[model samples]
Target: MSSRQRRNDSAPQYLDATTLTAWRNVRDAGEVVVSRISAEMENQSGLSLDWYGILLHIYEGGEDGRLPQRELERHLYLSQSGISRMVSKMQEAGLLRREPSPHDRRNVYVVLTDLGRDVFLRATPVHHAAVQRHFGSWLSDDEIASIGRGLQKVLTAEGGSEIQCGEELDRLVTFGQSVLALTSDTVAVSDAILVRDALEPLLLADAARHVTPSAVQDMRAIVARMSTLIDSPEEFFRSDWELHRLLAGYCHNELLRSMYLTLLGTLSSRLDSVVPTTNLTPYLYERLSVHARLVEAVSSGDEDQVAEAAHAHHFTMARTRLVDAPGE
Candidate 1:
């Protein structure tokens, strides 16, 4: 039999064993929960899961809340025109507006509005329920904490990049050459799918924001959900990537997904001067705190507070990182 057939045949035999079976059940249960929550979110809030994610980012960015399309593209791994189109659509919907960036004429800023905020405020509860119904119900405090530590260990072993564009990438490459410095444990080729899964929605939402805040938020929610997969890097990456690609495929724009994968692939392979040394346990603790805060903010309908806390939480992961490269 071929390698593919061999792997598949081996998978069932192994998966049937007790340890692997339990692990598979946990993963499958989470997936079911998410599906139920997504459906509920759609029915009650009239917002898809992806839009919820974008709203969180905007909420995090705060009042006077805005980010340049290019910046969004870089931070979120979105393409140029993709973000532009998204902005236009959202502007028409009155959820977000576009203005020329003061710092650069070539750049455009995407800003949320009162209407957008109101929608987010109302949807918070429904979304929270979905989260609880899914992952929260299955996980205890200690188990969740353990998962966080495990994920952090993986991140340390697989340090990622700042995820910039062509121009920024060139600048960093040149700087590294000049300093004779490079990050150890740079993102490797094998991790491309994970990186791609991380970037896809951020880019699409950046583009969609121009069209509709709800759509942009939906994309963001998808990004957030994808990011939560610290379960099995290899399996989760493969499973999630296929799922999103399949969903994006329905739009008849394979390029949307393909481009995201390509960008992530590049990011997975690129290196800067420093490798991540973040401890998984501490990082997870921080993330758990953030999740608790998110639960509270969503319940209270305090979008601004939620946004601020989320940004702060993501930043703390750097505390455990190795400031200098691994070998030196």
Candidate 2:
């Protein structure tokens, strides 16, 4: 028999039991829970999940409550025609407006209106309850982290975001240089602080101001994991990266996501740097407290408090990092 035919003949025997079960579970869980959550959210708020998602993306887009029309379309996974129709309806309802960018007349921006904000805020609790009841509540924090980590691996293997533009890819390559030259413990604390001090608070504020209900659940899960890992500093910090990544996702800015992930990647090249000296036990406890507070701030939708907590969680600080090379 041809090799292809031979493999096909043996396919049944070669099927790993774990693989079979995992695939089925992933498929079933995603479809069933999403369907139920959609039904519940629509019933309670009269806003379909897709409608809420549009308002959500715009809400999370930035402090200005706007996103470029093309970028918004790319993120929403809708066809050009579908987005046009939805935007028209949302505009009719006073939920959104498509305004030409003053900076660039050719580009239209999707701006969330005050009515959209009210509707989104009103529907948020319903969405959260449904997500928790149907999805997040069923999983332990550790399970949630593990599942997130595994799926992220799959996403990475699959070339991650289809929407990653050339510029984003080019910048991501720069993060790789630090990977080659530095490990976790050797990363300069001052350099990490520079990135964290500036960008981290903004990301946290965005998360607090506009995170989707599903993203909130993920943040809580990571915080729960961090709470349990107060003694295990390395594990705790890895979980911290997960929480920050969740925070960054809600910002709805791909370029910003890249920048934050670069900071996180450089700091967490391995893990040990996050918890250096055993004598720093007090500092570790304090970090856990700050993380818990950050989550609370996010969950409560308190933007200022979220920014404050995130700033308080700043990593170790030292002196300025010298440039080792050009364009670094």
* TM-score, per-candidate, Cα-based: 0.38, 0.43
Per-residue lDDT of 206-311 in model 1, one digit per residue for the tens?
Answer: 3322333443345345445645654433332333344344334333345665676565445433434321112333443454455445434333434466455435
Residue pairs clashing, model 2: none
Poorest stretch of ten by lDDT in candidate 2: 168-177
- Give the C-alpha miss distance for residue 105 in model 2, angstroms: 4.3
Model 2 per-residue lDDT tens digits across residues 165-256? 22211111111101111233322432553676578777777657778788777888888888788677667767877888778778766777
Question: Which residue segments of model 1 deviate by more than 4 Å?
Answer: 1-34, 74-78, 152-328
Q: Model 2, residue 324: displacement in angstroms?
A: 58
TM-score of 1: 0.38
Candidate that scores best on TM-score: 2
Backbone clashes in candidate 1 total 33
